[model samples]
Target: MRTVRFSAVAAVTAAALTAVTACTAKSDAEDGTAIQVTAADSTCETSTTTVPAGHVTLKIENKGSKATEVEIVFPDDRIVAEKENIGPGTKYRLTAEVKAGEYEIACRPGMKGHGVRQKLTVTGGTTVKRDPKLDKAVADYRAYVQEQADETLPRVETFAKAIKDGDLEAAKKAYAISRLGWERTEPVAESFGDIDPKVDVRADGLEPGQKWTGWHRLEKALWADKKIGAEEKTLADRLVTDLKDWQKRVGTAEITPTSMANGAKELLDEVATGKVTGEEDRYAHTDLVDFKGNVEGAQKAYELLKPVAAKNDPALAQELDRQFAALDKLLDTYRSDKTSYDFVSYDKVGKDDRKELSDAVNALAEPLSKLAAAVVK
Candidate 1:
């Protein structure tokens, strides 16, 4: 649908920057029970902005000409439920079970700016205890993220040392290997303040007057600028130190099923938005490597929640499996006899091929986005 996705840094940083599945009370409503939210070019109007706290559903209809999205934002700005790329004349049903509290409904028409908003007061629903099975699933994912961090941080130390030692070849080889860990756990990583920007900021994401640093900076020095001097070495060292700090924080971080599902979608969004455009690993032309890592990570996260998703919506889960397999098939075409992908420069991809990749990603993202709400039920 060509959904306009603002960068996560700009769109969601103020919020806790995590997507959480709401523990809404288990209840079924009549077919017409959902509130009708109409998203137009300049306004977001709803049938009713007030509702009982548990198990609220919004039948969001995008009436605007442009692609639009709807978000149910918690008091802390965390997104409890969201539907992206609701193209004109299309409608999507977003359900969430939240505590009795005030929330905001943010509608992004044309996928730009802070979306038009309305106060959504959720009141008078009984509080439901957190589910033990969901908690167990969350803990397992956290452990997986921690394991990835443990493995990745040490390799990054080596990558930084290689750069410091003026071993550009060694550093270049290590670059792809090290990123494997980071991409898998990026959703959880984004929660740790400062670490995400320090470790993975793209040049465009930098604030005015901010010098570029981290992996991309080193990538430019190694491949494009062809100079790995003191400045680049310093950046590499700082990245390693930050990664170590990030590893320490992983154990203490909280992961919810919703966050994991959305994280998977977020990684693919990276592929659809920047990586495919060659904006991410510009110098190295290694966007394919990152793309693969994102897909793997997303796949793993979804797999963890597969049981719950199946229980709630078996058809949706089956469709997701089919879509993932399709995307995986497309990605597999890029591999070569060498351990690494035999990817040409992004500029070299044929238009038809590019469209195919985009289509596959969008296909996966569509069904995948529905998983967050399904599992929480």
Candidate 2:
């Protein structure tokens, strides 16, 4: 299952944008320095709609029954910054950089649909200096994300072609291949606030009245039902079109070093919550393919930030490197063809084998979680 993803922006011009969770939120809110937001099932209230552009802090409390998400988004629904999966009765502090412009404070109840919203106006504010090395990390990470998006389109086309041609076996072969690029850079793809739910939302993740489309929907048709029909053919074409949108929009996505680090951590969370549990590729049993993609994506981000992170906190960086290697080596043990993504079927793995994989993922995830703070410090 896919949870909501947090999105952050890199510094552009004299004003660099980024997001972090602030621990001193109570004091900040008490001092009236942070914007107070109250979220409920159908209502989203903010202390003020206007703020000086620069570093904006939101003190959010979810009073709703379900887990909610809050985002500062552009009018076109591009996420400026967001914090997802805020549980009921929980308070969270979300801090992000903003430029003077029009945006909205969106509260998504149950982490689905466009929930309640309030207008947010950012006024002129002073610019702050940023570390140049962090900027380079952002640039490189952006390019890598774009490269993955560029590569993913053609593979998706191949999968779509197989589905359209009614070649069940061929479609099965193409399914995992097409998803490699997506799984790698899912955070970037998900930043758009709309694409992920359309292209990647699992059956269980769907809300009421939501039409099931994209990979998993088609996966059910191919592997579970064992046949392709008219709806399946139409869905294949839709998948290609949706992914093309992702490819075109990749260049415009917001990127920051912290976001890259956070995204890397999210990938591991995805593995622990979905891939390792055998729930992601439930019908196809190709969870290992996705597991590799998530790890590769996380590692790519970690490598890009290693220089800065090492300088700030050498011990954390070293531990991260060691854990990542351990996890990779453990994963390699399951690969039938070491040169390819040909891992043994997840169903074939024994209970103890699954536990080993789970342990490896958790070991790396613990240290990787600290990467963002190390880089910024």
Per model, state how many residue pairs clash: 1, 1
Task: Score candidate 2 by TM-score against the native.
Answer: 0.82
| lDDT of each residue in 1-377, candidate 2, tens digit only | 35433333211221221122212222243212368888887777787767766556678999889888888889777776676767899997665556789998888777766556778888775523457887788899999999999999999999999999999999999999899999998877877877887889888887666688899999999899999999999999999999999999999997776668767887897898789999999999999999999999999999998989999999998999899989988889889766798888888888899999999998998788677657655
Clashing pairs in 1: 24-97
* TM-score, candidate number 1: 0.73
lDDT of 1 by residue, 154-266 (tens): 88988899999999899988887788888877766765435666778776666544567778778888988877898988899898888889899888764667667767777
Q: Estimate each model's TM-score.
A: 0.73, 0.82
Predictions in order: lDDT: 0.73, 0.80
Measured with C-alpha atoms, the lDDT of residue 129 in candidate 2 is 45
lDDT value for model 1: 0.73
